[model samples]
Target: MTAIAIDHDKPDLTGDTETQNDIFLQVFNSGDGALFDRLYRDDAISNFSGEPLTGEARRKFFVEFIGAKPVLEARVTHSYVAGDVALIGVDFSVKGTGPDGQPFTIEGKCTDVLRRVEDGRWLMAVDRPVAAGGLLPE
Candidate 1:
């Protein structure tokens, strides 16, 4: 996808860290798998289990994962934006029973990079998650 030429003069509050965090919340809360398609570009990349995903593969991952979860929530800790790139540091906790009725909870820290597209739409360019303070090793 072509990158948008950001207007540096005007502060991009929309693509700032807070806005990125909001976008994440909105998509997850909507539970509409298509939301991913709208929020991500065809060539957008993501870090899932150390594997990169692009195009339809990325959308399918979220659809299947979220569909299996009873609930999911993301909280932002800090964020910043530079030109066309927005960086967000977040703390997330997900609680849900798996498809097999196995209950589970995970706490983690996530760093997300959102890029502005040529069409002036912001989409997730990258998402990296690190296990936070909990039973999981960092």
Candidate 2:
């Protein structure tokens, strides 16, 4: 099966984290990890599972994450942009089947750091999943 490839600026938000996050939801719901691969830089880091993800590992994790076919929605609660960098706080809900085919849904918050490219496109630089007050334990 061929996965869909989402544009990096699909939603095309003008430095708006809320709409960008909504676009993330749309990309996630599309069940396409390709979009994630494109949204993150080669050196981008994510701590969604406590451990850091970078280089090929980040891509691996995203492949597995998206491969799970999760249905997710995100609402940005806070956003700050200065120059070429931005920080966003989001509350999100995700429902999906586990590896054992068990159904699961997680509602949590996250903090994401994004950087604007030379062409004025935003991509994730650091994405840390926030739950239970702070970063997910390692």
Off by over 4 Å in 2: 1-14, 132-135
lDDT (Cα atoms) of all candidates against the true structure: 0.64, 0.74
Clashing pairs in 1: none
Tell me the TM-score of each prediction against the true structure: 0.75, 0.83
Q: Tell me which residue pairs clash in candidate 2.
A: none
Model 1 Cα lDDT, one tens digit per residue, 1-138: 223333323222255565555555655655655554456666767664346777788878777766564455777788777888878888887776767878987678877787887767677777777665443334
The candidate that wins on lDDT is: 2
TM-score, structure 1 vs. true: 0.75
lDDT at position 82, candidate 1: 84
lDDT (C-alpha) at residue 30 in model 2 = 75
Best candidate per TM-score, number? 2
lDDT of 2 by residue, 1-138 (tens): 233344554423237776677667767777767666667766888886568888888777778888788988777889999998899999877788988989977778888898887667777889877665444773
